[model samples]
Target: MPVTSIVKDPEALSLTVHAEFPVKVARLWDAYLDARQLEKFWGPAEYPATFTRHDAAAGGRSNYHMTSPEGEEFHGYWEWNEVVEHKFFEVTDGFAHPDGTPNTDLPVNRMVFSFDPTPEGTKLTITAAFDSAEDMEQVVAMGMIDGTRSAMSQIEQVLIDLRNYSQTFATEAELVSDTQVRVVRLVRGTRQQVWDAHHDAALVKRWQYGPDGWSMTKCDLASGIGESYLLWWAPEDGGQGFGFSGKILERVEGHYESSTEQLEGGEEILGSGVPGSVNQQTFTGTTGGTLVTTLITYRDKAARDAMLATGMADGMEASYARLESIL
Candidate 1:
């Protein structure tokens, strides 16, 4: 479909605005696929929105509500079907009363999102088709264009900030510097699934380690200090052992504490003679699933330098991609 205006009938009393978001395909896919993220910055001017009863499958039902600052509430729902991640989704949207009564005048839109990667970024084109000209015009005049533009602007900045943080956080010298690393990913799955992936050593071995034939050898799940694990990365190419040996320096169980250890260095590797600081992993439950956080500290300059020199950013990104795949 062509990227056209949402103003269905400008000569009539109503018009709707359409927007195109030039964003990274992965980020855009996350924005749509992750419901928790939908609740964050989904609307313009902080218009709070909640996604309720979302199944995100064919013949399933989902609803959304936008509450204005002045105590006004707008409710809508969709008979969700034909979902293809980062490709397309069709929904029946309308004026559902706060009490769940549907209004027929509002249109049910077939929304399509296509991602085309280019040198600049992914061209995200979102198109919605309304039933009639009047319905299209009504939604258009409600600031759909400006609202979408603002929300997408926020999304673009968010991606940029995340990429910047990934580089700066890894290469920085100070352990607890002026800014700490923060994870804002929206993990989609059941709580049990997320928790299992997190605490299970086998799953961690698959996701946390690099793809060059790496695996976890040991883990201690004690609730106190001094618990530790050794992740052994023995490549099949007859490469030497290269891995991180971590020990719990402090304990907070479910919340977060500190894991201090050292990255072993071989002839091709460089281990930090100084303590490699601590890694604080925090897990929190959300409506859809769990949010996992990892904050690593490299207090020593040499440690940070070695990791960065080995393409830390790419490695970290690959690790995250693996994690997503596992979950």
Candidate 2:
């Protein structure tokens, strides 16, 4: 592949690599655009990598975060210099704190990626130039090239697998049984704003789901121990269809939990039914700011089985991902 055929510049401090995969440009382009798809493949050479605030558009910005050997997180952002759809794109990259504060000491890089279509497949050429030889040496020693190669290879594989999966499952909706769906991710801009997003019926509908014909008929949010909110879903088929109903049974100043069994119907009878779950949301003061934890418990057995089947511990980890965006 192109990554294996890389050669450093003899006169200048630079490296150029070409990777040729037996995949079409269109397939690779889709993988690059979908944030979810990118999440599956994008990362550095050795350790796992993550991206945030990713807007792959002109004049947009994003941050890449990766963990070190000691579990220290290092992150950087790239403000797009240029974006040319599936053809090529350029960006100016630099180190930064998770909160977008730039670090001045780390060297900045301008990288250009060109995607060219070939008869055999797609050819991707990457050119990243550093300000000095030391900069190049430092990054190479850090194994940046290996990380990039692995990420690109992963992108190609995702495309190939997606095509195969689509063909294999054509008749029905993809069954993500025992999956975690996003409930709400709140980043507190203010105490009142946080409360409104979670408690206000009108505002909740804007960000949360609104099913067909179902609407919030009544909601009450009080401040003391009895403070609570309830949403009554009115099914389109006039109560004969599927609907959802939930209430805040208990509310602490900074947290609340939703009871699953009460909403789904009395506790499940053995294998016949499972109790509704509970969602407990807590807000704590942190050095960075307020950190919120929305812990959801779906009875021990149900939660454990779901985790074991899907390689996920609980919905908390997945919820945290959606929370990162809301915050």
Candidate 3:
């Protein structure tokens, strides 16, 4: 994790974030100035950002939007007030409408990003000043802290050498918020290959099952938006079986997909102490292969915690590792 601490000062009407990355100051600075790298970590895992235009020079404006798994878009803009290459930059960040018009109804913030070389690597500090304590508290209540932390924690992956982040890397899960968790891994396959492996019944049957002694007994797949799938697994030794059923909510071929998932029996399963969740999966083609990120949004904090406690990520990791081997 790159972010060290996030401090709030009511008297100063500001929120400051401190983070250090093991990289040169120039490299850290470029990650911010370049839209390509910026977008990768600008928003949280589930809501990915896209910068339509970026100009960090003085008097320039950068426009971007983050799209939620449900297709909602949140727009924002940064009006560059000052720029000092490899040192610091100042901008007035504000909320905007989908059409790019400024949304004055929402509170705006003035942000300053400072970069300095450190003994370990580079230190980056960001201070966002607000007009009043009311505005500052409002943003905090809107989950800004967790969102920023989730976004900043992803910087390390973007900063690492591509060779070090290849298919050999193990799967990892990061808690983004009380109700969300992000799992990521590098697969030894192209984005299309990964997508196909997930959709093809034959490939899915080969790897989607759990650990040793378990076999997938049924695989009813759904390949398009608004479709549904049912997958069941049982122990080869005749132990009890369980299954998952989900409905595809969104999809962008070879890139991203989102679906609502739950235990097979719906109300019957819910009554037995299981809650539903939404999963968003995104695949990015990397130099080595494909990077797969799955963001799971649980019904509540308790639900999220329970799901994680069930060793779901561990099972997924084993399944993904098996997929890579077959690929």
Candidate 4:
């Protein structure tokens, strides 16, 4: 939890938030300026924000909108007034229409965020000053206190999980459950480019090979749900080959896909007797690159452990490294 306390003062016409984090002051400051990290916690969990434009310099502006679970969007912007690196910044936070025009019916607040270093970590203090008592009360009535707390609660994960979101990091796998795991990679390419690389036969053959000496011999892909696909790889020195055959269970264009996958051949393959897995993949665009998340659900814990013990993560990293060069 990044936020420790929230104070609302009626007579002072101000709302202040105090949050502590066990990170260097510079790292904490960078997370706010980076749009990728900001979007993760800038809005409430139900209404995640997307920042189409974020300018960090003084006198610059940031344009963002949050969409509710019901698909309604609320636009907002910030006019940066002053910035002192690793210390504090001032901004005018306001509500806006979908067209980027200010909504005069609502109030804009002057906000100053101070960052201080302590023996343990960094402490962030945010003071938002309102023009009138009525305006301050209005925002509080709109669940501002609860919403702010909910937004800041997510910051701890972003600050701690550096490898998961960093573009330069190699592909990694995270355990989701006893019978499930998630493989993630931040690849340098547009979502469409990454999608095409997976679907195009020639491109797939070029990089999907796990490591040197192995080559993709078959790359039959399915572009629609219910269709079947086949992937096979073999060694250059006439070594035994292995492959996976599955049907596309779900397809959402360049955004998401899922299928049932199983190992078919190759005596060298580990956990060959275990039942296969269902893999669902999602592609999300970020400021640095595209985040590819593949969730694999196996038949049981034994099967999941077996697959991971086969050096699967390292193999995937090698392939992703190849993908980086081509893209």
Q: For candidate 3, write residues 264-290 as lDDT tens digits.
A: 743332245566899877665555566
Full ranking by TM-score: 4, 3, 2, 1
Clash statistics: count for each candidate: 5, 8, 0, 0
Q: Give per-model TM-scores.
A: 0.45, 0.52, 0.56, 0.57
Residue lDDT tens for model 2, 1-327: 335567678466777878887777766665554334555776754455555445455565665677667777788887777877579888887889766677877778788878899998888887888899888887788777777777766766677677532122111111122432212222434433454466555665444433335544444444444344444444455553222344455554433333332342212212223334555444322112333334345555665354334322333334233333454
lDDT of 4 at 243: 89
lDDT per residue as tens, model 4, 235-315: 889888888899998766776678999887864655466468998776655556766767788999988988888888888
Worst 10 residues of 3 by lDDT: 161-170
Taking all chains together, the TM-score of candidate 4 against the true structure is: 0.57
Which is the leading candidate under TM-score? 4
Q: How high is the CA lDDT of each candidate model?
A: 0.56, 0.54, 0.81, 0.82
| Residue-level lDDT for 141 in candidate 3 | 94
Tens digits of per-residue lDDT for model 1, 1-327: 122354444444333343444555555555554444555556675677765434455565555677789968788776755666555566666668776567665655665555666565566656666666666666777767767655655665545444433222121122222223333343555545655665667787777666566544444344457766666666666667676677777543343345765666544554444336466654434443444445555665665555545655466656656776776
